[model samples]
Each structure stands twice: as structure tokens, then as C-alpha cells.
Target chain A: MSAPLSLPERLPAISLDDVSRTYTSGGSSVAALEQIDLRIARGETVAITGPSGSGKTTLLNLVAGLDRATSGTITVLGMRVDGTSERELAEFRAHHVGLVFQDPHLLSGLTALENLVAARLPFGHWRDLQAEARRLLAELGLGERLDAPPSRLSGGERQRVGLARALMGQPELLLADEPTGNLDAATTEELIGVLERVRREHDLTIVVCTHDPAVAAFAERVVRLVGGRVDGQQRLDRPGPLEVRSLEER
Target chain B: MALSGALAALLLSGPSHGYELHATLEAELGSTWVTRPAQVYLTLGRMHRDGLVTSERVRQETRPDRQRLTLTDAGRQAAEAWLAGGPADELVVRLAVARLVVPDRVPSLLGTMIEERTAALHRLRGARADDTGGFRAEARDAEIRAVEGQLHWLEGLRGHLGELVARPRVRPADERAAELA
Candidate 1:
């Protein structure tokens, strides 16, 4: 491992400079995101908000190394994400990034806890990942449901389990897309609170794409996307109900 | 009772004055909620006595003391329960509370509601198709048509979505039909 992290100050968790992504089909193309520039400092929580076709998921995929930029550059943990080979990118993500989705991809037959255990089985950190999975599940209030299969758990419980699996890798960066999309208000609040505590305790940098104002309120900054571009960015000061939008807009 | 639940749900964010709560409720629920100032104050007073909210008089330098209100732990729990609990008949009140409590989730809630109704409609039609023409067949078909109309209206909302809700990414008709089948 090159271990590029010994710099003077740990570099920003994520840096994107003039990035653009285009998809081509039938000799025509669609620009999913263009002229985007953003930087997320270490240990900060930022929320990405937007309507459909706004490239919110595209941005997350690009950061996670699941997709590549057509131009420009992406640097995460002081490593170049754009130009990295697929094998290198996979290796980097396994060591650094955690991903949570609206519908978590868990093995149907496995128990909640086992799902986590099996994720890193290929990498052979069985004991460490298991310990982390158990601790994370307990902390997330799913300790009682640890043995339940995915189908048996409630939507909220399953999402919490998804979070535990994400944390098992001990990743420094967490990317969640519509994490609270199917959750109830109380569950949403609880999950966001958990994320906040994890960020504080672990010094993890989080980038979440959400539609919920509560998520935006808890974030250090909110970056809004529109028509594949950065529409607005705001650093919040716990403005409570007004944090997401103004009274007039509501 | 719905307003009382709504009030409890609103304070889950934190503290607020009665006026601000009323204004926020009015803004969120819009014309559907026509609560008056006196009603809001009366309800707050009642909630204070019931231990749902704690009220304190915050003294301003240039003005009279204003009553500031905050939710008790009990209040928060009750609101959480109320926000997450609703039968089909209570959908309107429940959704209003959801919109007020978690504005970011309105679109998701709406989408879930629509899918559920559509599924119910499909079941009703399925039962009719396999029926032997019972005595109540006509009445049952009417109920099915009503649900179909509601589903149409809900689907229609997606087309004219505003800034608050994301415009849904509709799948191909064939895909949706296959899933439903």
C-alpha cells in the first residue's frame, strides 16, 4: 500500500475539479453532470439534494468509483479516482468507502448479522468485520434482530442493518443515496442521529443524497443539484425548521 | 385531535412560540388547515397542562415576555407514534402530519400511497375476474372503479410535481404491467 495519507494535513476526503459525465446512445449523448467542482473536508457531513434526473446518484457513483468522469479529475483520500484502473479502484473502495442504498443489497438467505460477515469474507477479515458488525448492529438498535433474515425485518430495521454492513469495512467515507427514502419520521430521526454520532466519533466524511429536510438540517453543508449542475450550496447553523427551505417556499 | 397530534409532531424539531407554530402549521398544511390563533394558544395551554410541552416566559429587552414552548420526552414519543401510525381511513390526517413532520419525505409517502392503492385495485379486479357473479358484484365493481380513479389522480400528481417533490422516473408501461401481472 502506498499509504498516501501521511501528508501535512490529511487531504480533503473528496475533491472534484471541473468534472463532467456524459452518456452516449445512438450517436447522441446526455450530460448527466457537467462543470461540477466540489470539495468535502475531512470529518464533515454534506447533503446532496435534488429532483429526479438531477444527477444526484451520478455524483455519488462517481465518488464511489462505480462510474468514471468523462473529463476532469476526482481525488479521494489523496488518491486519483478518475484515472485509476478498475482493479485499483475496487481495491481503493474496499479500503476507504462505505455505501448505503435505499434498498440495501443483502443476501436473502443470510441473517442480518451474517450478511455483514459475508461482505468482507472475500477479503478475509472475518473476525474483525464480525466484531464491527455486531457492535454496529447493537448501536443501531438492531441487536435483538441480529439473527433475522432480510424478509423478516421491518423496513427501518433492514436499513439499520444495511448501515451496519456499510460500517463493517471501517471505511473513512460513507455515501448514502436516499437513505431515509422509505423510513418513518421517528426512524429517520434516529438514523440521522446515529450518522451524526458516527461522524463525530470516527471523524468520517459523509455525503448523503436525500430529499428529507431533517437530513439537510443535520448536515454541515447542503449542496443542491439541478439539471446536472450545482445549483446552490449552503452551510447551515442549525436553523431548525427553516434549515431546508424558507417559510415562503414551504 | 388531529390538530393536537399535528402540534405535537411540529415541536419534534425543538422549541417554538405558539404563533410560529401556527404559522408553520398553516404554511405546511395550507388551506386544509384553518386553525385560528386562539385555538392554537388554547391547545398549547392544554398541552402544557398535560405535560406534553413545557412552556416558559422568555423576557425580551424591548417587549413583553413571550411564552416559548418545547416538547417533553413524552411529547416526542407520542408524536413519533402518531406520525408513524395510520390506517387507510386516517390517511389524510396521517399524511398531513407526515408532510409537516418530514417535508423531505412527502414525495416518498405519496409514491408509497399510490402504489398501495394500485395494488389494492389490482386485487379487487382480480377477485372480480375470478368471480361467479355474486349478488354484490355491481357494488364491488363500483368500489374498484373509485380506487382506480384515485390511483389515476395520484399518478397524475407526478406529472405536475413542484420543487418540493422530485418528479418520479416512470418506468416503461410494459415493465409496470409485467410487475403488476
Candidate 2:
């Protein structure tokens, strides 16, 4: 019998090699992160978790090309992100990376559909964008709220809109910073459900920066950031009966 | 009875040193905790020496040392009795202890901990619904449905918790919040 081939290890969508960030404040240099090394494979959902000032947010910004590093190289979606020019990074983010923050920085005047359609403006096509936006919203259980503005939408609904806005461009990589940071308990759980469904359906790579264990539980791997460096990691699998039993037993 | 009960409750699940027990409890309580592994091992060693339980060296591939542990008949009985009895105030106290010690981390830790619990509940529900035919056929659908319902409820709770941890709190019962005004 021919040897069965295992699933090919997916190529990393993001790589940070010996990356570090330092800030000079009042003639004293503070290290935000140092000696960071990470690899995020395509289609993988990885959670970056830590306490405040642990460099979790800094790591996200670096990957999204929102900020530059003081040392080492960051490669995002096959482009060298660390040394990329400002224009290059902006273009790269627009084309390859989709960002969602804790707060839905949605345009106040725009409807949910309009906000989603806006992602296509930079690329100059709004026709298909609307249809895709509707499809995404409906899939995320927001079809009824599509015409609502940010002010009228509930916390969960708004977060779904923000998620739809991110997916409107169909970017290969999604970087979210505490996407549920401003919701109620019920809404947070609902948002996580939507995220789980979308992640599987879209087959997109998502890196979420959160300290919430609930959020981390969904990720295949949870990387701990400490003192601005990769500290340790926890590997989690889809919880099964055996695992539940183990947990209960534990 | 309180200390013995909590200790037993932890032990009933499996064998753990005092430190690991503390960590698990802290995690369950959703607090920023500091329980050194060495300290746990020390307690286990002492417990072993005291005849509360018997332990043996267990080799783990990823660990540096063989963890010494095993619950004896006395230990299991103690654990079961403790858990079966009732809740203890100290259970909350330990969590408070962890929270107080790590005062700066209260909000973040609580947020993370709530998230973890919510996720864990979802996962447990999902696990129960697997089409393995392991669960009874008659109870399967009802159980799965119940799990799904709980998952939804947990989401709502998590959302509310998120809002509480962060900004201006909105009273769910308040007419303004109801109107989104």
C-alpha cells in the first residue's frame, strides 16, 4: 500500500524572527518586547494572550504593519513587513490584512451595509461588495440589522457588523485586538460563536489578541506573551467527551 | 471540613499536589493567581509523609522531573466526602486572596477567566453532541439541544460581562438601554 500523506503543513502567513520593540522615554529606553519569534500558518486561528503591557497589542500592530520594529524582521503574507516603506505597508494592509478592534470604529453616519461596502472603496468596486457584505451579514446572523447604524445596533450586533466589515475585503489574514472587549457576557459568547462559524467557513487565518480564556479556548494554539517576548504556549484541541471527562476529573 | 472538602473535591478529580490544586482552583475562580509548582510538590510530599495519601513517581515526557502523586483510599474518601458535603466560604476567599495579591490584574484576569469558562461550557456542549452513539439515543437530542441553548445563554452573559469590564455600564432593565438611545 502506498504510504498515506499527512496534511501538508501549511506555510506560515506571518513570521516574526527575533523581533523586538523599544521606546525611548525621557532618556530611558523601555523594552516593549524583545527576542520575539513566532510563526502563524495560513488558515490557523491563533490567540495571543497576556496581561497588560505584555506586548500582546504590540505584536498585533507589528503583524498588521501598523507599526515598525526596532530590531528583527516581520514577514506578513510573504512580504517583509519590518522594513517595508509606509506606503508599502499601507497598501499591503489594504490588500492582505483585515483588522478588527475591541471597539467597532464604524462610521457613525453609515449603515451597516454601507460600512461593509466601504472596504471595497480603495479598490474601486462597490457592486459585488454589497452582495458579499449582505451574504456575510446574513451568515453572521445580522441580516435583520443590516440597515441599522452603529448607534441603533446592540453590542453583539455591532461587533458582528465590525466582523463583516473586516471580511468584506476577503483578506487572507485577520488581526483582531480583544474584539469582545466592550460587550456584555451574553454578547461575548454570541460573538465567539459567530467567529467560530466564520473562521471555519472562510478558512481564513485569524490572530486574536485577548486575555480571555474563553476566546483562547477556540484557538488551536494559545501563545503567552510576557515582558514583551514569547513566553510559553498551550496547545488545545476541539473539546471532546474524553477531554471533558478529563476536565471534570481534573 | 471546609479545607478537607475543597482538598477532596480537587482530589476526587485526580491526584494533584497542593500547588497544582491551588492553580486549578484559581483558574476555576477566575482570578490572577500565583501558585508555585515547587510549593505544590512540597505539600504533596508532606501529605505523603503524613499518611493522608500514598504517591508514586510518574514520569512525563515533557516534564523535567517525575511527578510524585497517587491518591490512596483515605485520600479518595476524604475528597469525595468533602465535595459531597457542601460549599465553603474559603473557596471564595482563596480566589479573593489571589485577586487581592494581584490587585492590578483584577479586571483583565476576570475578563479572561469569564471568557475561559464560557468557552469551556461551549466545548463541553459540543463534545456531548458528537455522533459517536456513546450517549443514549433518547437523551442525545435533548442533551445536545440543552447544550446549544446554554451556549447561547453563555454568549449573552459574556457580552454583558465584557461591557461591565470596560466602559459606562448600561442597566439592562433601564428603558434607555432597551431603546438603544
Candidate 3:
């Protein structure tokens, strides 16, 4: 018999080597991020923190293939992300990344289930997509609100719907920008718990950029950015012995 | 019991001196749990007695000898059990007792906690955004929900206590004396 096909070893979820992004307007050039070298391993959770105008979003945009770097290389999921055509980048993103933003930007007219269904429609049959969307929305604690329009849902609920929509594509890497910025403290905590649970369930690699220490506390590693450069990096010890439980036990 | 289990779990990670273990636990738990060094040592002693952990005295260079503790097979199993178990119910009992004894202060205490947590959440929200992607955003959302749940529970508890206990209305002694006059 022919040798059974084996899956390739997982590569770094993201790698940015000497990456920089500069924007020029009116004969003045502003460097958003300068020479950032970062490698995030598969399934690792990292938080990038800095002050405003510190190029935090710039770094995320680069990795998501939303924006090309002005210089250097960007690799995501073992593919070159820095030098790809727009069409190629779009395909790579659709296949490998799930993006969440401050605003869910969900269609206001669509029901929660419909919103998720819309995200998956391009990739699967409508019947299967609708079932998958229902499953995701239910998993995200939106089972009751599945038929509710975005306008009727609370800010937190809408965000959860957005998250479910993101998962509809089943991207390996999840990238969120200020996902909790629109939420109050209580909602933020609930969303964080949901994210953690989802991450564990999906076996995903996640990168979040935030100024909040409370949010950073959830990350295994925290990278500090300042003036468009990496200032410091620290590995946060997982809190509590309860985390020692095996995945099956959890 | 949780602390003892936590200590054992730490050992399961690898062998370390008492002080090192204590530091690691403190770092891990942060302000969530206040762990005294003495409590850690006491638990270590108990765990050693139970044969859940074994210790070896290592002679240091120009320093005091330290006991390097390691988890035994039984200890590893016990640690896993502890990890799988739910949190203690003592917290609920303690809160119930506090509600009875100090009903008036309960709301204020809860309010203070809510304020602190809200401030922390806002601080996190205000932190410079980074590109780590959707995972951190998801993590933040989870945190927001947790804090919101606590606030909701506290608010509900406050309302319940308010209904159960009415603040006593007392006339001032001077007012009574004036009325007598």
C-alpha cells in the first residue's frame, strides 16, 4: 500500500522580520512601524500593547494582509504575506485569517443567524451554511437571539454575532482590533471568556492589540510597542492551577 | 485544599525551591489570591508528609541549602484531580454570612468592587491597539463579559438586600430633647 499521507508540521502562525510601514502625504513621510521582528507560534496567544500613535494597528494590518509593509518580509501561516498581489492576499486572508474589528460592521437588516449565513454563503451551500450559522450563533450564546436583527441586539451580543461570523470561515488565525473598545467592563469580561473558550475549542492562534492590562493578562505573552518599535516582551505565567487540567478534562 | 492542590500542580510543572515555588504561584495568581510564603511552606510540608511530593536538599554555592521539591506519581494524579474539580463553595457561604451581618455595607463594598473592575477594564480598552489580531480582541470581549456579569450579580444582590432590610429611621437625641423641652 502507498504510504499514508501525513499532515505537515505546523509553522509559526505569524512572522515579521525587519518589517516597516511608512505612509507619505504632502511631502512628509510618517513611519508607522519600524523594523518589527515578531514570531507568533501556532496556538499561542499574544497581546501587543502600546500608547496611541504607537503603530499597534499598523502591525496588525501588516499581518492580516490588509496593508503591505513598506519594507521587509511578513510571513503568515507559512506563506509570504508582505509581497503578495491584492487578489492573492485576499484569497490567503479568506483561507487563513479571521478579522474582528471595534465595530462588528454587521448588516443591520440581517438577523444574527442571517449575518453568519451571509459570511459562509460564498463557501458552502445555503442549507448547510444556515445550519452551520445556527450552530455557531448558539455556541456563542446567541441561540435565543438568532432571529433578532442587529439593531435589536445589545452591543455585546452584536459583537458575539460578529465573532460567530468570523468563525464561519474557520480561519486558523484570529486577529481582532479593539474588539472590546465598544463594550462596558462587564461585557468585556464576558466576551473575553467567550473568546478564550472559543480559542480552546477551535485550537486557534490569536493576536490582540490593546492598551488594557486586564486584557493583556489573558495572553500568554505580551509585547510592548512604543514609538513604532518593540520596547519589551514578557511571558505571562498562566494564572491558577486549574489551567493544568488536560484538554480532555476541560 | 485549593492552595495545597495548586502547590502540587506547580510541582508537577517541575522541581523548584520553596521560595521559587511561592514566587511562581504569586506571579500566576497575581491579586486574585493572596498567598503568604508561610502558607506555601506549610502546604509543602503537608504535601511532603502525604508522599504527594518528594524533596531533596541541594547544597548551594556560597548560599544556604534549599529543598528542591518534585511531584510524585500520586501527587501528579492528585494535582490533575484538583484541576478537574470545581472551586470551593466556601465563598458563597461567606458572602451569605456577610450579607446577614453587614447588609448596609454590602452595596457599598460591591459598588467599590464594580468601580475598581470598571476602571481596570477601561484602562485595558484604552491601551494602545496592536495587530495581534482577533484573538486578543476576543480575549478582551471575554473579560468585558465577566466583569459585566459580576456587576449584574452585585446589582441584583444589592436590590434583594435593599428589599429584605430597610434602614432604620432614628430621630436624633437632641431633637427628642428639644421636643421634650
Candidate 4:
């Protein structure tokens, strides 16, 4: 007898088909990303990596709806990011995506807890979000310094606050650009640890654009872009942990 | 990288004693962290010497002697330092070595590695650690992630080197970053 089909409540968190972005300036044109076909399933983590102009951010921006692609379709949690109206995109971002930038731009005057709470201020009552903000800070190991303002926090602490702020939206998908661009090795490692934990706890599908291999390596899959094209991709499904096999050139 | 700090965090909230600490660590961080009791005790002995923690043997009736480990002021400070974090190095040296020696082979493997590393990272982080174990799971997760990161970086080195030495420039990555801004 055929078994009943069981499907996940939600499947791929993000889908991109023949996606491309070209910026035409004065008389010339530049392709930041070209023909990008990618899929990220629910609870997956993917890293987009490339050189300075490989369109890592452009690809991320397209999925985020911060920028539209010249061609192709981008679907995130069932919504069309490319063709959606600005208002719809804005709403989608507010409700579905969490963004962590290279540098977490926190309101200088606000305390760490306040910054997290304030991000969702426009969406809900301040009091309702306060507890969750506190929990996030504590979970990130910043509970002891919740009252500290951005100026008072260390580079690592500030980044943790930034992450906490991102989680405030409770979005299903997270997008980060060079999140560790500013941190030291030890701190970067620490932040990656936090990110790893949060993604699982929150059941988030994360897409990060980074130049750091350490950061990219932490993802479930790494997508490499060369000259704005999908040059190659690999899945880290091999057995063993911390196994270092040097590349023996063919 | 920061194993001591995490080891300290495990003892901070609840000063696990004897078999308790060893059992707790195993339960909280899973095999991704220190699993053996002897290793945990050895670490405790080192921590005892470092003044990050204090260890005491409390005898019980008809049972083995319980080792009570408590976090010291310095241990607490160490945990705090971990939270504050330190400056990061820009380059990953292992990958640099691969690029220096296996330049060609490095790219094919490296390009694939970035993908594999990402996947590796996802699976590592996706492993279930203790949910309510306070900072214990977090510290353990950090330790695992940091170690995995090193391997991933080493693999990724070739990919970047390949980009620099090989591959005709179809377009630069940030050529539009300036204009897009």
C-alpha cells in the first residue's frame, strides 16, 4: 500500500531561479550577480562568498528585496521578492527577515536592551517586546551588561547586541553581510558560536555574504561566485569533524 | 580557542561536583564537547592550578569521593573576557600554506570546501545541545564552532588564491558595491 504523503509545514525558505542583477552606469553596465539559481531549505544555513566584486551582496540584496534583479525570480517563504511592491517588501522584511550588517549600527544613546526593544517599537507596544529583548541579551551572554550603552560595550559585545536586535523580529530567515568583518579571531569565533546556536534554536534559514572562509565554512553549504556567476558550490556532508585534508592538485 | 572560559561558565551558575560536572557537561554540550570524565577531571586539575577554579574532595557514605569544583573570581573574569571577546586576526595561515604549495589543486578543492564548510558548520551547529543548561551549552557550542572554523578556513584558502591567480575576470565582486551604495 502507498504510504500517506507527509510534507513539512514549510519547505525551502528561499528560492532563486535565473536571478541576475546588472547596474548600468552612464554608458557602461556592470553585472553584480548573474543567473543565480539557488535554494535554501527550512532550517538551512548557506554562505555566499566571492571576491570584492563577485556579487555576494547583490545576490543577498535580491533575496532580501533591498534591490531587485534585472531578471529571474526570487521567492522567500512563498513571497516573490523580485516583483513585490515596495510596501509589500517592507512588510515582508519587517515580519520575515532579520538582517545583520558588517557593523551593527545601534542607536548610540540607547542601552543594549533598549536598542533591541526599539527595533520592534514601530511594530508593537514597547512593553510587550522588552522581556523578549532581555531574554535575547541574556541568551547571547550579555545579560550582565544589558544596561550598558553601545559605547560601553566591547567590539564583541556590541556585535552580540546587534545579533540580539536582529532576532527581535523573530524572522524565519536571517541575512548577514560581513558580520565578522570587524571582529578579531577570538571574537569572530565567539560570534559564530552564538550564530550557530541561535539559528538552531530559532529554526532560522540563514544566508551570509562574507569574504572570511572561517565564517563561510560554518555554513551548511557554501556558494562561490566568480565574476558574478555561480562558479561552484559544495555541501559539507562528509563524515568526521575537524578533519583537514589538503588539496592535492589534479 | 576559549575552552577555559566555557569550562568556567559550566561551573559558574551551578558548581557541579565530582561525577555531576562530568555528567552535566556530557549532557549539555553532547560529544561535541569534552565527554570523558577523566578529561574533565584533568581539565579541573589544570583549572585548580590556574586559580580559575577551586576543587575539593568531599567523601560520601558507601560512594566514591565527590569532587566539588567551584569557579573562582579569576574564572568569572575569564568568562566575562570571553563575552567581551578579543581582537581577531585577518588571515588564516593554514590555507595560506595550501595556496603556497598546492596552488592549482587548492582551487578545485577550495571552491568546493567553502561549500562543504558551510554545510559542515550548519550540521555542527544544528546538533542538539542542552536547552536549559545556562551558559554550558553555549560555551561548548562556541568551542566546537571555533575549531570547525579553523578547518573551514584552511579549506577556503585555496578558493581565494584560485580567484587571484586563475579565472579570467568576468566581473569584480564589489565593482558595483561602490555604485550600488
Candidate 5:
């Protein structure tokens, strides 16, 4: 087996302590999340699943530093995300967090290569970034589509490119919001395979917010959000041995 | 036979090398089907000899040449035939034979079997709970239902066995002989 991607031994990738997010509209306040506490270890794959309006996206945003919690603390990669300044959060996001939306959000006019290279521009010059982007895209099975624009690529291919773009920053944590929502069954399976492979190869801590059970099943653990609160959490059993030898022995 | 037939069907979709074939089978069948590299090679050999598959060696730069396997017309026909046939009821066959030979022990045996099978199914269900793949989910659901049906049948058999035991039938010759001895 390949050696697991080494990470800082004890520091968690994410921690949420009594985190809550509330939105107010028309003089009525709605809790998008309530007193949520969660910890995700480094290099772990977790899926946040629930019905619509269940706070899955809200929780993901808090972790990604895109949205601040109304109450409680959120720490990701040892950074205080809950109350961090926008500038600090932006810097943290640039270096440590990669986000993928339901739509790939790739530029319509940019080629696949350009989209990835462009994402790296904020970090530095794009000259050396091209080779890394190309390699990442190739690893995602997009080598042949390097010059193809988002309009020309299939949904699965676009998602793969999105995934490639996420890796450009070499982010430790990858947060995807409904990554496979638009894909067909075959494409969904393909995307799952790609995600699993990429996670293993790069040792990424992935948290995908989705309602699809299939997508949730790919994760090592699943946390169910219900009505803006954590309803339950389940650790999915990895595929085990073919036969339970004890049964036969008996 | 299941493994060979599955391999043939996989080849019908597209030609693949040995390693790729093993990976594909694992993905398709999940952890239920345990296929070793040797088993894949052995099955390929048999199929090749039987004119069901053909192989061509493709040279690699840094490694030894690999053989890519493709299905023959006969292989395609055989795979279709295999798919057309209903699955064998192995559990039924085993239970029937066990009941004939050890009627007294059938209830206990089946009880153990049911308990084990149920536990296994629960584990499988938990493992596959989040799987979104259509083929994997459908296959898992079918297997779960089959196990449940068996459990239901076993319960009924246990009830009937209880009634028979309660009827107080005459002791068999062996039992009588043992008592006299």
C-alpha cells in the first residue's frame, strides 16, 4: 500500500465548537445552524449530508471561512475562522482551503489549462505553474482536454477540471458543495472514483456537502445535518474481507 | 463460473489488460467477489484455451510486456447465455440435503445459518449505505432481499420442526438400541 500522506500528528484539520449561523429577513431570524460541534482529522474524507435547508452548506461555508458563525468558534487548519478578518481569511483560503461549487465555475472563455493556471496567479507568476497544472489535470484524466473550454467538456470532465483547479494551491482541505449534482449516474460514479483516488494520492482532507447518498457513501464518515443542527454521525464501514471465516469455521 | 462469466461480460464492454480487469471486477462486484491476480490469469488461460478470449502482448517502456485480453464471438455468446440463465439456488440445495441426512439437527443448523447470514447482511448494508452507484446498490439490495427471504423460510422451517418434535413420535432403532445397551 502507498504510504499515507504525512500530516502534523495531532492537529485536526477542522474543529467546530457550538457553532451557529442565523439569518434575519423580514424581522424574523432563522437558525441556519445551531450549536454544531465537529472535528475532522487530517487526511480524512467526510461527507456532510442532509435535506435542503438542513445547514449543510452553512456549515461548509463556516469551515471554508466564507461565512462567519453567529455564535461559537470554528477553527480550520489551526486558524480561527469564526471571527477572522476578511483579509486574514482570504490569505488562509488562498493557502490552505480549496472550494469547489456545484457548478465548476470555470471561465466560459478560458481553456482548461488557463483556468487552472489563472487560479495560481495570486500565489505567484504563472510560468512554472503551467507544468504543475498540466500534471494535476493529467492525473485527473484530463490531459487530452487541456485546451478544451468548459463549454466543450462534459459535466464529468468539467468537474475533474474543477478538482484540478482546487489542487493548484496544494490546499490541505478540499470542500466541495454538491460537486456531482448535475452529473448522470455514470458520471457520478466516475467522479466518486476520481475523488477517492485523488484524496488517497494527495492525502487531502475532503468535506463534501451533498444530499446524494451515493456521494455521501464515498466518505469515510458522514455527518447528517437536520434543521440546522447535527442530527447524527455515522462512520461508514470500509469494504472488508470477502468471507467471514468465523462463520465458516462454526 | 460467476467470476469467469463476469470477466467475459466485462470484456464484452471493452478490451482490457489483466490488472485493469481485476480492478473493474472489484468495482463492479464490490467486496463480495474476492478475485486474486492468479485467479484472473487462470481464468484468462482457460478462456483462451476454450476459444472464448484472445490476447495480444503490448510492449511497455519500463516494464515487461502486458497481454491485453478481448472477448471472442464465442465468449460474447457464452456470456449472454450465462446472463440468460436463472441463478442457481445453492442455499436451497444445501438445506434440502441437510434436512434429509440430519432432520434432528436441521433446526439448529438453520438457526445458526440464519443468524450468521443476518449479521453478514447487516455489515454489508452498513458498508454500502452511502454507495451511489446504480449497479452496486442494486446488486446489494438484491442480495439483502435474498438473505431476508432465506431467514423467513428458515423461521417457518424451525416452527414446523418444533411441531414435529412435540408430536412425540416413536424412538428410532438406534435410539432404542442405545437405551437397551
Candidate 6:
């Protein structure tokens, strides 16, 4: 594993410098994103909300180092995601970044416990991985589901499994892509609570790509994307629905 | 309802093993359908007893023996009926009424609803690209388009809700006001 890069003096957890992505659609190249500049600080949960074709997913892919930008640089965890080689990006993401796609994406073959253990092994560390995995499963109300296969799990349970998998590696940066898109309201809140717990416990830098303000209400900051650019932004100092407990209550 | 339909569909596709049917459903439903394999097989066993399908053990040279399945005539009839039915107009209910009913969230929810409709439209359009003579491509497209228009109207109403629910804000008395004087 690469040495943890020293963060810049007072630098944010993530910074995007004039990033843009273009794609060929209908025989014409369309700018999926404009020159987007944004910053997210450590332990901050930032939500990117946008309409379809506004490039919310594209922006997320760039930040998560899953895709490269057509232009400009993206600094995440003090490394340039835009210019990193594929191998480096994969390694970096495996160790420093965790992703929750819209779908749970759990391997059908693995049990809930095995799914998380698999995520840990790739980081070249399995010592006590099982214990960590079990703890996470317990947190998600899946203590009984440790041995259950994907087929036996409910829609919500499968999502919980996915969340546990993402956090198993204990990555500082967490990116979620519509993690609650398919969930019912009750399940969505449950999932959000799980996410909030993980974020606080790990002091994670979290970014969520969602169109739902209900989802965005969990974030400390909300950035609206219009035409692939930051249309508006607001810092949510007051507690939103996601914050259910005060420090004293906890 | 979707699961039962899927079960019938898979059985009709071929005499498939219970595990294969579960995998097929997972692939089709993406994230919405969640269930364990053992439970699915147990359900299949129940269906077998109920005369929906038949199951048998097949010898495997590799590791463990395999279970195979075949749909009965009744299963085929069920699948046909399911395929003939149109989409069910059911609202997805959740516990986040505070978020959904809250007036401030109206605009963003409306936007997301529109995005979902657009994605559904793309799916419909793409379905037509393959000349599957079995489906009514034109009718499906029209139906999806109608839903897309309705989502647009919902978006308009949500914007209005945002306006109606916003509280009156009193700006702080500014030093600039005294400077202007």
C-alpha cells in the first residue's frame, strides 16, 4: 500500500479543479459536465443532487476514481484522480475509497459475512476481518443474516449487506450512488441511519449522489447540479431529518 | 406480485434449477428484489408440492449433486397471464413521511421523479431497438410517454408546494441601511 499522502495545509478532503467530461451521444459530442469546481472537507457529508443528464453520476465517477475526467484535475485524498493510471486508481480506491452503487452489487454466491470478508481481503488484510464484518452486520440489524445468501435477504437486507461491505475496508472517503433508490420509505430511513452511524463512527468523508432531497437532508452541504455545473450550494448548519439525536442524548 | 411473475417466467423459460431461477430474478430486478437462495428454493419446494412445478436431483461429476426443475402446465398458464398484464399502478410507501410530505422537499422530489421517468423512457426506447415481435413496442412507448408527462406535471405542483410552504423571512437590520440614510 502507498504511504498515506500528507494532506495539504488546511486543505479539504476533496477538491475538484475545473473538471469536465464529454461523451458522444446521438452522433454528437455532448458535454456531460462543465468545468466543475468543488471541495468537501474531512468528516463532512456532502450531497450532490441533480436531475437526469445533469451529470451527477458522472461527477461521482470522477471523484471515486472510477472514471477519468476529460479535462482538469480532481484531487481526492491528496492524489490526482484525473491523471492516475488505472492500476493505481484501482489500488487507491480499494484502500482509501468505498463505494455504494444504486444496486447492492453483492456477489450472489457469498453469504452476508463472506461478502464483507471479501472486501477486506482485497486490501491485503484479513486479520480479524471476520470480527469486523460481524460487528458491522450486527449494526445493520443483520446479526442473524450472517450466514444467509443473497436470495434469502430482503431488498433492505441486501442493501445493508452492501453497506457493510463498503465499510469493511474502513476507507476514509465514502461515495454512495443512489444507495436508497430502490428502498421503501421505512427501509430508506433505516439505511440512512446505518450510513450516519458509520460516518460518525469512522469520521468518514462522505459524498452522496442522489436526486432526492430526502436523501440530501443527511448532508452537511448540498450542491445542486444543473447542466453539469454547480447551480447552487447551501451549508446546512441546522439539523436536518437525518440528525435525530443531540450529543447529550447520545 | 413481481416475484411470483418472475418465478413463473423463469420456470417457463426452461426446466431450470431453483438456484438458477433465483439468480435470474436478481439480475432482472437489480436492487429492488432481495431474498436469500435457500428461502427461494424452499419456496420452490412448496410450489412443487402445490403442483406449480416439479423438482428432481441430478447427478454431478464435479462436487455435489444438483437439483433440477421443470414447470408444469399450470405454471406455464400463470406465467402467460402475468406477462399479459400491464404495469400495476402502486405507490411505493415508506416510513419517511416526514421527508416526503415535508413541503421543502417537494421540489427535489419532483425533480427526482422526473429523472426516474426519463430513465424509464430510455428503457422503453431501447427495448424497441431489438425487433422482438413478441412485444407491442408502440403501445409500450406510448404508455411510458404518458407517465413521463404526468411526472412533469407533478414537478410543477411540487414547485408550487415549495412556494406555499416557505416561511416569511425578516432580513436583519443592516448597517448599510444606516449608511444609505
Best by DockQ: 4
Q: Taking the tens digit of each residue's C-alpha lDDT, what string does model 3 give over A1-91?
A: 1122233333577899999999999999999999999988887778887667889899999999998899999999989986689999988
How many pairs in model 3 have backbone atoms within 3 A of each other, for residues 3 or more apart or on separate chains, i.e. clashes?
Answer: 35
DockQ of 6: 0.01
lDDT of 4 at A172: 89
Better of 2 and 3 by DockQ: 2
Candidate 1 residue pairs in clash (backbone atoms < 3 Å):
none
User: What would the TM-scores of all predictions be?
Assistant: 0.56, 0.63, 0.56, 0.62, 0.58, 0.55
Return the candidate ranking by DockQ, descending: 4, 2, 3, 5, 1, 6
Separate DockQ for every predicted complex: 0.02, 0.10, 0.04, 0.16, 0.02, 0.01
Backbone clash total, candidate 1:
0
In candidate 5, stretches whose alpha carbon ends up further than 4 angstroms from where it belongs are A1-10, A237-239, A242-250, B1-181
On residues A1-250, what C-alpha lDDT tens digit does candidate 2 reach at each position? Answer: 1122235547888899999999899999999989898998877889998767899999999899888899999988789987778998888787778899999888999999999988678775788888989999999998898899899998888888988888876789989999989987567767877887878688689999986656666677789887897877765544433222233433
lDDT of 6 by residue, B84-177 (tens): 4312221121101212224354345444554444344434433434435656665554554455455445444544454544643222233235
The alpha-carbon deviation from the true structure for residue A94 of candidate 3, after best TM-score superposition, in angstroms, is 1.3
Deviation in Å, model 3, residue B59 alpha carbon: 51
Give the better candidate number (5 or 6) by TM-score. 5
Residue-level lDDT of model 6, residues A103-169, one tens digit each, is 9888889999998998778555565899989998998789999999999999999998998888876
How good is the docking of model 5, by CAPRI class?
A: incorrect
TM-score of chain A of each: 0.88, 0.92, 0.90, 0.92, 0.92, 0.88
Candidate 2 segments whose C-alpha is farther than 4 A from its true place: A1-9, A238-250, B1-122, B128-181
Residue-by-residue lDDT tens digits, candidate 5, B36-151: 97998898899999999999999999778999888999998876544433122334423433333334655656545544454444455554556577698777666655655665
Summing lDDT over every window of 10 consecutive residues in candidate 3 chain B, give the lowest-scoring window: B88-97
